[model samples]
Structure formats: structure tokens, C-alpha cells
Target: MGTGTGRKFLFVLGSARRDGNTEQLARLAAEQLGDVEQRWLWLGDVPLADYRDVRYPVSERPEPTGNEELLLDATLEATDIVIASPTYWYSVSSSTKRYLDHWSNWERVPGFVEAMAGKHLWAVTALAEEPHQAGALLDALERAAVYLKMTWRGGLVGVGNRPGDVLSDTTALTTAKTFFTA
Candidate 1:
């Protein structure tokens, strides 16, 4: 089950609740990635401060600290980035949105954009509504990937509400078995 491809996947879990349907679905898809390195980062655990628009102020922003540093480093080290977030109001969760907002600051770091270019981006989401409800969330991620010059590897969506609900989604489970196969 070893990929031996040196591909590292960074799974950013953006759900408010631990072990929620979104995380479950993401874990299922990740299991298909074989022995490739995987790092799971729960957004709640590494909370980010609200992003500030300092670009126009001629102000110098301090270096990233605490969880911000951790996340930034993990992001740079990974060859693939998986945004694992539940569909909240037809878009990404607040915590997840916050993490993405920090990308603007990261972009200021020398070579950050170059480092991200050509990397793989993927999404995994679960929603109480139909899979189509995740369109906004998927579109945002896909667009961000393109902006970063990363390859969009598509997304996996599962319909579920409560914890463990996605487990009963036979269709999702079947897809999960081969979601990351390619």
C-alpha cells in the first residue's frame, strides 16, 4: 500500500465539531490514498485570528506566530492540500474561510506563491442538503486553486447531517474507496 511517490497530503479539517460527518467523509477518501504521507489539521485546534487588510496601510505585519506558523509550515511542506470542510450556508465554514483568508499574508512571503504553484488541491465536504448544495464551497476552493496555480483534482461530496450519518451513505462510501485512486 506504499505509494512511494513522495506525495504528502495536508488535510485541513474545518468542521466545528470533532469527528463530524465532514471529517468522516474526508477520512474515508483519504484512506484510498494508500501509504502516502497524510497530516490532519483540525482548524478548531489551530484557530487563526481574524485577517486584517494591512496591504494598503503601509504597515509592516509581524511574522506568523503560534498556530499560524504551524499551519504555514505544514502547507509549504505538503505537496497536496485537501480542504475538508462541511458546507455551511452553501459555502465553507467560518473557520475554514478564516484559514483561507490567511493565504493573502502567506502570498507576501517570498516564493510562497511559487512554492504553491503546481501543487494539488482537493476538497471533501458533507451537507444536510443535496450534493449540489456544495457548489459554492467547491467553486471557491477550485478558484483558489487556480489562483495559486495549483492543479484542481476535484472534490468529493456526501450528504449527511449528524455524526456518523455519512457512514450510511452507501454511494459515498463506494466512491470513497476509489476517490483518491488517481
Candidate 2:
């Protein structure tokens, strides 16, 4: 149960906007990991418009590129993963959504369950506060956590989808770090 300092940690940043609130938090977490052996893969840049076939087609199996497969496979080899995203419209971004839709593929690999049986996962979400707003994104995330069979270390929310909003919010930053550590 001890990840220690040498274990590999993978963080999948899922934001469409570059340097947005969610991306900033992902960067902050990466910086704070401090000597724990980690790698941050920014999948937010993948043009989601091209990912219409998220669940893959029934006629043929989806084959991952070397980099894509590496991210999936590394979950078994890595100590943990942080799935960070901006709560867009009401859930994770299309980029991250597409990636998560590919989760079913892992079951086909040998020893996949035992390999990733108890791996830790954290879902971080940043949402803008609005009139009568609710944690709809968190609800979607909870379902995913249930299906993934991974520990949900919780999330980070903010009223900052606009530029430079979360920058000075001490409470938001504290919330982010608290969930990460918890």
C-alpha cells in the first residue's frame, strides 16, 4: 500500500482549453508530486471532434497507437493516476470522455484485473459556479469510479472557468490539495 518515492504516477489532463483552470491544477499537482517519480500526459490537446467513435466500432477492434497504449498499459505498472478535467457543460471534456470510453479494451489483456486490482485513482474537477448549480459532473465521475473499480480520492471544484479566476482563491487551492492528499 506504500507508493513510496520511486513509483510511477500518471496524470491524464483532460481540458480543451490550454492553461485553463483544470490544466493549471493538473500542472500544480505535477509540480507538487516532488521526486515521487511521475509523468504527466496532456491528452487535452487531442481534437475531440475526431473522436466520434469513442467506444470503437463493432466490426473491428480499436488499435491504440504506441503512445495511447502506453498510457493504458502503464496503469498496471504505475502506482497511481489522477484523472483531471474541467467540468464542461456538465461532465468531463470530450477528450477525456473518449479515453475513458476505451476502458473496456483493457479487459481483454491477460492478468489485467489482478494487475490493476487495487490501483488508486483521483478524479479532479473544476466547475464554474452558477445559479442553481449542482455537482452533476461529480455524479458522472462517481459512476465512472464505480465502474473502474478504483478508489475515488475525491475531487477539486472551483468557480473559475473564466480567465485568472482561480488564481488567487486560497480556498480552492486548499480544497484541491486536500483531496489529493486525502
Query: Against the hidden reference, what TM-scores do the models get?
Result: 0.96, 0.78
Local accuracy of candidate 2 as per-residue lDDT tens digits, 1-182: 13465567777888776778776766665565656767667785433234334344543656556655776666667767777788877877878877776666655555765665566776666667651242676676666666667666666666575866766667767665645445
For all candidates, what are the clash counts?
A: 0, 0
lDDT of 1 at 20: 96
- lDDT of all the models against the reference? 0.91, 0.65
C-alpha RMSD of each candidate structure in angstroms? 1.3, 3.6
Whole-model lDDT, candidate 1? 0.91
- TM-score quality measure for candidate 1: 0.96
Q: Worst 10-residue stretch by lDDT in candidate 2?
A: 45-54
lDDT per residue for candidate 1 within 1-182, as digits (tens), equals 36688889999999999999989999988888778999999999999999885554335867789998999999999999999999999999999999999998888777889999999999999999899889989999999999999999998899998889899989888988888776
The top-ranked prediction according to lDDT is: 1
- Candidate 1 residue pairs that clash: none
lDDT for model 2, on a 0 to 1 scale? 0.65
112 in model 1: Cα distance from truth in Å? 0.7
Q: Candidate 1 regions off by >4 Å?
A: 1-3, 56-59
Give the range of the ten consecutive residues with the poorest summed lDDT in model 1.
53-62
